[model samples]
Target: MKNKLLKITTNLWFDTQAEEAARFYTSIFENSKIGRTTYYGKAGREIHGMSEETVMTIEFELEGQTFVALNGGPHFKFTEAISFIIHCESQEDVDYYWEKLSQGGDEKAQACGWLKDQFGVSWQIIPENITDMINDTDPDRSARVMTALYQMKKIDINTLKLAYNE
Candidate 1:
């Protein structure tokens, strides 16, 4: 068989709970689906030292990004260096994702609408206009917006605009 090129894939390591995490992620996203669940067993077993019913790997897609979750049994934990940033158009959108991701997890709001979810995933629920404010032609306005963003956990666009005008 010829090897065919495919889409981008990110592998996530979990401690015997990859399937569970995949399900949770699929549930949260709108355009998402579970692709395959591979188990261990038999001579053609996909996973080593595991039974046929044991979850070995899971394939899932979120917003068109493919990801594989491997149940490697907790050799590692998620760190803050890599994270998913969600751009929000409004406060409602921000609240929805923030509430859902923060479930059963810790929360730390960073300046400029960035937050760390319970799973140690960093997310930025920034407003659409943030870019415009930051890239404003007026240096004073841009500086003000930057200052406002530095003091906020969840960005408020109106407040940012007001600051930019100052």
Candidate 2:
């Protein structure tokens, strides 16, 4: 019944921190929760190199989006090719998520509103309407916005707006 109540869900492969990651993710967003948890049986243990009764997977919902975390092993890792984009409405949201997600994460990856969290997951904490603002019909304004954006790490919406208006 793992698929219940979900049309499509993102499955994140983890070494052994499925439950812990699920909890951390749920704590970050509103309308989030740590859902069902599955464990490894004897057969599962043999196949996955995990012990019996060990955590196998964790199901979680972050802001109504479903996600599954599997304790598969170190065979798979997260890359920047795929990232979760958080569309923020205000500077507070951008600041909060940026601070929280990148707490123990990679500071080196912090550029242009993108940061890699401690879990090795990449996140784009961006302000809403940024696409519209940056893609404005005015070429000069658009160029300015792009320049401002390229210089930012955790996107400052106010600064972007100022760049757009200026």
- Determine which window of 10 residues in candidate 1 has minimal summed lDDT: 43-52
For 31-69, candidate 1 gives per-residue lDDT tens digits of 999999987558555544455677879999989889998
Q: Which ten residues in a row are the worst by lDDT in model 2? A: 39-48
In model 1, where do residues sit more than 4 Å from their true spots? 1-6, 42-52, 109-111
lDDT of 2 at 92: 95
Write one digit per residue (lDDT tens) for candidate 2, span 70-160: 9999999999999999999999999999999998999999999999998899999999999998778999999999999999998999899
Q: Candidate 2: lDDT over CA atoms?
A: 0.92
